[model samples]
Target chain A: MNTNTQTTRLYHTALSPYCRKVRLVLAEKKIEVELVEERYWEGPPDLKRRNPAGKLPVLRFRGNLLAESQAIVEYLDEAVPAPSLMPQQPLERHEVRRLCAWFDDKFQAEVTRPILNERVWKKITRSGYPDSRIVKDGLRAIKEHMDYLAGLLETRRWLAGNTLSLADFTAAAHFSCLDYISDVDWDRSEALRDWYATIKSRPAFRSVLADQVPGIHPAAHYAELDFG
Target chain B: MNTNTQTTRLYHTALSPYCRKVRLVLAEKKIEVELVEERYWEGPPDLKRRNPAGKLPVLRFRGNLLAESQAIVEYLDEAVPAPSLMPQQPLERHEVRRLCAWFDDKFQAEVTRPILNERVWKKITRSGYPDSRIVKDGLRAIKEHMDYLAGLLETRRWLAGNTLSLADFTAAAHFSCLDYISDVDWDRSEALRDWYATIKSRPAFRSVLADQVPGIHPAAHYAELDFG
Candidate 1:
């Protein structure tokens, strides 16, 4: 670890998959960080100052303000070499990044964001009621995504390859959010269920599992190790 | 370059910034790739086969089917190291990736996609008539983005830093798309305009400059070296 006197802090929202991805990577690398929940929807005045993108999961580390979850995690991996979250080969590294995009770009748009926007964020922000149609669409999309993951898991131990990489944490971060709302169907695929259970049991996952968003209770089995 | 008997090919749409970004990187790296236009919006059957996410800019390189624009470009930079598109330092690299995300995720969502959807895509797909309000909103958004880029250029040589990087290509890709539809107000920022002109004059930009989408015309100054 590149030890700096400045305390590493993460500004994030509890249910955001992007924020959770950074938290998971930070924890997996065993870096101690102080977490500050940012109500980004409320649009804090300093939010844009922290990140020009005006998004959450901004990290204050080593005298640098890092934004964008993927960039931050990749920088973390490069800066902290031990317990590498990336594969050595360029081709293998591409696979890890491809899956990260799958979860962050595609899955987040299709499943996580839509579902959470309706289920969690709407309530937190005191916005309109949950749109059942949007929630249903997101629910429908998850099955196909689950099927795809199950097929990938049939061969590789981890999402990207045999070794657990950033892809696993990225995928798990999104799944954990959905799981928190009891939206995941654990019985969809035994392989995926096992994969989640394995990742969920890791020490790095402890902090995320302990997360509880105010005004919205976590699913009963969200933190259970053997629930599935 | 890792030579393989298999011919390198890129399945892409002409006006897609994501595809253009990959094309720019490929050209910048001096890699020869045969371009094949894929009408992804129509949902070609093999689109999903090439990329599970059903996205454009899938590259067949070194006999591997690669998806995701950022992943493909990063892999290219790593695989073919000469004339590197990435900075050596971790912090510098983070800046590049952060800006790439800014253009791809934020700018695309706020400015490029909406403007193109209303102006170009609707005409190409015959989906609906142009919505002036959406186009107006996108045009308005680009001003703030231009101001931000001009601010960066005031202190830095490139969008990310001193040397040209993937961030420059990514930002250029989006700007070019908007420039195609005459949506960009290059006069708004002198530094930004100079940066674009400098990048536009590169030999690597030739293929992108030559792009012609059916029934849609490029702006009079779009392909010009001294556009501003």
Candidate 2:
């Protein structure tokens, strides 16, 4: 795709689930965006100026500097109301937020951050080699999480509910990153694999599927339509 | 203050800012809640049963078990719409959510969790004495956060904006917990001090202000409305 400087821009890092979640939302909303990959670990001086928290997925939206992935996604949903990402009822919306937090916070601390820190960031940032123990712990934890998700999928079409919402994007963001490194054991939960496959086939997922980090190669079936 | 047992119930621990944020919002909405202090560290089976994440600030509200403090607060605002905590406009709402995430994720990690774990939780759990290094790090970190917040308070009446939104309550939730242990250096920022005093005087803050952990006594000026 040709770069469009005229559209809104996002300061993002490849494989950062937070950035991917926001990217998925923007794509789903059909908002034209210029993606500027940020080296967040280098701690660019301007990053802190753009976002006091000094985090990635900082969106320059219609001149407003928006930070925070969850906040950004929610804002996108509200501001551009085509294909609403949140449910209409308060309870369903609560479930969506709950699962989003489940991925962004719990699953992140237990699985994504630790695994990525050992496997990916160590390589990209030149920090150190992957700690096998930490990687094992993260891998061990993912099974339970995947099983729990499978249980949820048995009852509902989507992670949050019958309707797809931000929860899917948030969960997909983390899973896609893990999948990029071939970390996720998809066969552990057939339901979860199918759930992910369904989401991965979406048009919004194309940009993510095409992502390539310089050092790390995507898994063999990462972009394949019929991975299973 | 009577335990009605019939009104809505909240499973919470006293110094947790997440729980306090939910409590403050409940009080602000005039919803009476029975606060049940859970020994979450003990890892009760029911805790994980109620909240799959095995975290606190779980609310048994209207026959539904709600977890994730931000999700719960947003749900409350949606369910109980009188004196809405969120602004109508999407941008203002984004600001509120951003600040909430700032306190919950950034501030909690940098300051509240480390300091409280060393100073408060260690004693309550009989783990070990307060680690001065961690406490000092948390204390040192607070100066930057306080200055940033003071800058915001210099112009806006509330942390997020002119309106008293959930952002104020979310911030106050962390501040109040720190203040409970007399850890806050209130003199650092007059604007922040005044802001705290103003929010502290509200009736909604009464329950939290009165909180007393068994081994740890409240600060001399913790509950005083005009201590400054």
**Candidate 1 lDDT tens digits, B1-228:** 534638899999999999999999999989999888999889999999999899999999889999999999999999999899999999999999999999999999999999999998999999999998988888889998999999999999999999999999999999989888888888898899899999999999999999999899898988889776
Cα TM-score of candidate 1: 0.98
Report the lDDT tens digits of candidate 2 across residue range B147-220. Answer: 99999988999999999999999999999999998989999988999999999999999999889889899899
Model 1's interface RMSD: 0.4
Off by over 4 Å in 1: A1-5, B1-5
Off by over 4 Å in 2: A1-6, B1-6
State the lDDT at A81 in candidate 2. 96
TM-score of each: 0.98, 0.97
DockQ for every model comes to 0.89, 0.89
CAPRI quality level assigned to candidate 2 from its DockQ score: high
lDDT of 2 by residue, A129-195 (tens): 9999999999999999999999999999999999999999999999999999999999998889999
Query: Once model 1 is optimally superposed onto the true structure by TM-score, how far is the C-alpha of residue B88 displaced, in angstroms?
Result: 0.7
lDDT of 1 by residue, A110-180 (tens): 99999999999889889889999999999999999999999999999999999999999999999999999
